[model samples]
Structures are given as structure tokens and as C-alpha cells.
Target: MQFGPFLKKSLPKYLFIIPAFLFVVIFMLYPIFYNIFISFQDVTIMNLKGDKSFIGVENYRQIFQDERFLLSLKNTVIYTVSCIVFQLSIGFLLALFFNQQFPMRNFFRSILLLAWMTPLVITGTLFKWLYDVDYGVLNYLLIQIGLISEPINWLGQQSTALMAIIVTNIWIGIPFNMILLLSALQALPSDVYEAAKIDGASRIQSFFKITLPLMKPATLVVLVLGIIYTFKVFDIILIMTGGGPVNATQVLPFFGYELAFVNFKFSLSGAVATIILVILTVISLIYLYLIRKEESM
Candidate 1:
């Protein structure tokens, strides 16, 4: 009788978890397994439904030899690093400014977040026009201000194409960093600053010595999140440049999309996707390690 009661009580609890567990298995685990499986197979639209014969590491070898893939990798690194640096620096400064008591602080903060709130497609399209050679407001302003003698084609040239997208991404990412860092700044004890002032420390010394060290954890969070977000940027680049101007803005995600959909090289696309997965995984693991170490201390 006791055993029967225990079983009845536990069964409902287990049943409650079944839907969530099954959802994860079907949506998350299944797709990951399928991708890994096809990465080792020679799968294409021609034989997508007929055959998925294993080809060992042929896909990997081919991608390594591919010049476009190498270019995409290089572009990905440059885009990610540039976005992170600018986003962090600009966002931190904004956070510091808004954290202070001032007139219209909340109003200005909301205005600052408008860029982040705008949809990526809209932002991309808006920027594409802004960088237009003839009718762009940006070019008109620059010429009027005597910054340039002529309208410079921002997205139409290989030299400026990548930089254009990087600037857009940096703008989109700054609000996220600002909000996170602002919260950290608010949580810092005011007494620490008061104590520093008593010790004859200037504002600059207090910022470097106390504020920076205390904000390290929040900074790490912002950096890791920025890396992951910028590493997989797609829609903005797609709508803005379409990885164009001689593929100057081709990053890994766009490259993978082109390989799979445009070129119909499913196996090669899978390899590129796998490389991206590995990079994100490594960064995630490092983030977890740092979080654990921080907590232990």
C-alpha cells in the first residue's frame, strides 16, 4: 500500500516534466545530431533525398582549401573584433554618463536605445540609402561640412564595404552593453567612492583603480555576449551589402548560407557550420569557466 502511494505521487511529477524534455529533444538535440551526421556525408540537392553517403573528412579538407572560406574567416575575425571594441567603449562611456544624476537623463537614455530597438532589416535598409553615393544624406552632410570633395560610395567599394557593416553592427550592439554595464555601475556601493575620496584619490584614479576592477565581471559578460552575437551576424549584412563588393563583407554565416543554398554544396556548408559551432562552443565554455571561477572567489 505504501509503495503504491509513492508511485502514484511520483508519476504525476515525472509526467509534468515530459513535455519540456521532449520539446528539447525534438527541437534542439535532433537538429544538432542531424547537422553533425550530414557534415560527414556528401549530401546535396541532387541526391538529398536519395543518398547521404559518408565521405569522412572530405568536406573539411575541401573547405580548408577553399579561398572564399578563408576570406570569410578573416572577415569574421575583423568584424567581430571591431564591433566588440567600439561597442564596449562607447557603451561604457554612455553607461557612466547616464548613471549620474542629471536633467533629462532617462529621456536621453531612451533615445540612445532607439538604434538597438530598430529592426535589423529596417536599420540595414536605412543605412544602405544613407551610404548611397548620390542621394545619401550622409554624403550630402559630409560634402556640406567639407569632409569630402565628392560623394563616396560607402557600400559599393570593397575597401569601405566591410567597415560600413562594422559600424552598423557596433551601433546596434552598444545599447545592450550600456544597459548591462549601467546596472553594474548602479549596484556598486557608493561608500567605496567616498572612501577613495578620503584617501586623496582623484576622479581619474578612482575610476581606474576601483570602478574598473569592480566592473570586470560585467565587462566579461558583455564581451562574451558581444562575440557570440556579432560572430553570427547575417540579416544586416545581407540586406545592406549582400556580402557584395567582391565578397568583401562575407562572414562565416553568409558564407555557409551561400555554400548551402546558392552553390548547393550541402556538405561544404555543413563543414562551415560546424566550424562556427565549434568556435561558439569554445567561447561559451570559457565564459562558464570564468563565471565559476569568479563565484568561487
Candidate 2:
């Protein structure tokens, strides 16, 4: 335990972690700080590789004043909230169902996970076809069921475009929620439920009184992670709508991409990214707090 021997023994362990730590510093931390730095600067495609001129909070002010940014923020909030609600609800139900004894339960659960396992871009493209006004399965099925008189432009019309994306997102998100919640469900002590039953508690009452309270940590984790992931959704919306139908489905990340690449407003793009970074940081802090709380409990 002397200093020299301790240093010799610990050197290898410390060296093992150095590479990954350096990678994070070089790739993740550096880029994040650099982005924050440029967000306040008047950077552009023309001046990007040249010199960046700091302009204080001008970029922030400009983006705040931009109607499209406001609209994108609104869309992002709506999309995140809707996806969370449906995904958590449906996923929780699926978790509960699969947790019960049933034939082919594991098989069906694995099959359902195909949607989550599929690439988001691919899922978006597939749904684009499914949402087609004509020659689409959705409309065909609806017509077969006599729900509508004719095919409706699900992704073409502004009124329905956001809803279409939300539906696809929920489909892709459900499996993740289900898998996590199911694990939490399986981890619950059977003795608790047995005791509740002995006390004459109904299934519904037991679930509300015992299952829910125990699952709070998992639920919070799912919610926080869901919000962060859904907020940063870009490829799916980009491939499906390109933030189109008059920008009805434009979210903050896509809007930032537009500002940086499509519009070549690097400063504005950085500002939007900084905002997203702030939001994500807050969420991460909440996640860390929950983890600590759970551990303490």
C-alpha cells in the first residue's frame, strides 16, 4: 500500500480508462464547448473556416424573434409530450400484458420490438409510404373498414402531418418503454403482491397501491430519456416530411439543421443547438437526481 507500489499497480487501471476519457474529451466535450462558443458569434459558411466574430447575444435575440424558431419550439414540445404520453401508456400496458403468463409471450414481445429495432430513418420512410394518400395500406384498410369515404392525405396536409409523425414516433418508442417497464415489473418481489392478495386487495388496487410506487424510479427514467430522445428527433421527420407541409412538423433540431445547412446561418444554428443543449442538460440533471434518490432509498 506504499505510494510507489500503489502507483505501479494502479497505473494499468488508470491507463485503461485514459483512452476512453480522451476520446470523450476530444470528440464530445470539445465540440460541445466549441458549439457554445460559436453560438454567440456571427459565424457563417463564408466565415466559418475564417474568423468567428463574437456578437454577444445577437444570435439568441434574432432566433427568439424568428417566428419559425418559435413555431419549431412549439412543434418540439407538442411532439415530445404526445410521444411520451402514448408511448408510456401503450408500453406500460404491453409490459403488464407480457409480464402475465401467456403462450408465445416472449415471441410476440420480440416481434413487437422489431419496430424499435428498425432504424428510425427506415421506419420514417416505411411510414411515409403507409401514410400515402393513394395506394397506401392505411387508407386501404380504413376504406375496407368504411371509416372514411376516400383516401386522405395523411402527411400532405398540415392538419394531419404532425399527427402522422407522432403516430410513427409512438410506434417506434413503444418497444423501448415496454422493455424497460417489463424489466421493472419482473424485478418486483412476488411476496408483496401475495401479501396484498392476502389482505383482500384486488389486482387493480394492488397495482395502484404497490406496483406504481415501486416503479417510480423506472418511470422517471423512461420519461426523462424519452423527452431527451424525442426532442432531438431529426432524421425521421427529415426523411418523412423535411419539416414540410408548410413547416408544420418542424422541430428545433430540424430547424437548427435548416439554419446551419439549408440557410447557411451558422450563428443562428449554433444558437438553436445551444438551446437544445441547455434543455438536455436540465433533463440529464433530473435523471442523475432520480438515480441518486433511488440509490439512497
Query: For residues 68-127, could you state the per-residue lDDT of candidate 1 as single tens digits?
Result: 999999999999999999999999999999999999999999898899999999999999
Model 1 misplaced stretches (Cα beyond 4 Å): 1-16
Off by over 4 Å in 2: 1-3, 290-297
lDDT of 1: 0.93
On TM-score, the leading prediction is: 2
**Location of the lowest summed lDDT over 10 successive residues in candidate 2:** 45-54
- The C-alpha lDDT values of all candidates are 0.93, 0.94
TM-score of 2: 0.96
TM-score of each: 0.95, 0.96
Candidate 2: count the clashes: 0
**Model 2 Cα lDDT, one tens digit per residue, 1-297:** 599999999999999999999999999999989888999899988997898887999999999999999999999999999999999999999999999998999999999999999988789989999999979999999999999989999999999999999999999999999999999999999999999999999999999999999998889989998898899999998899999899999999999999999899988999999999998998899789878988898
Residue pairs in candidate 2 whose N, alpha carbon or C atoms collide under 3 angstroms: none
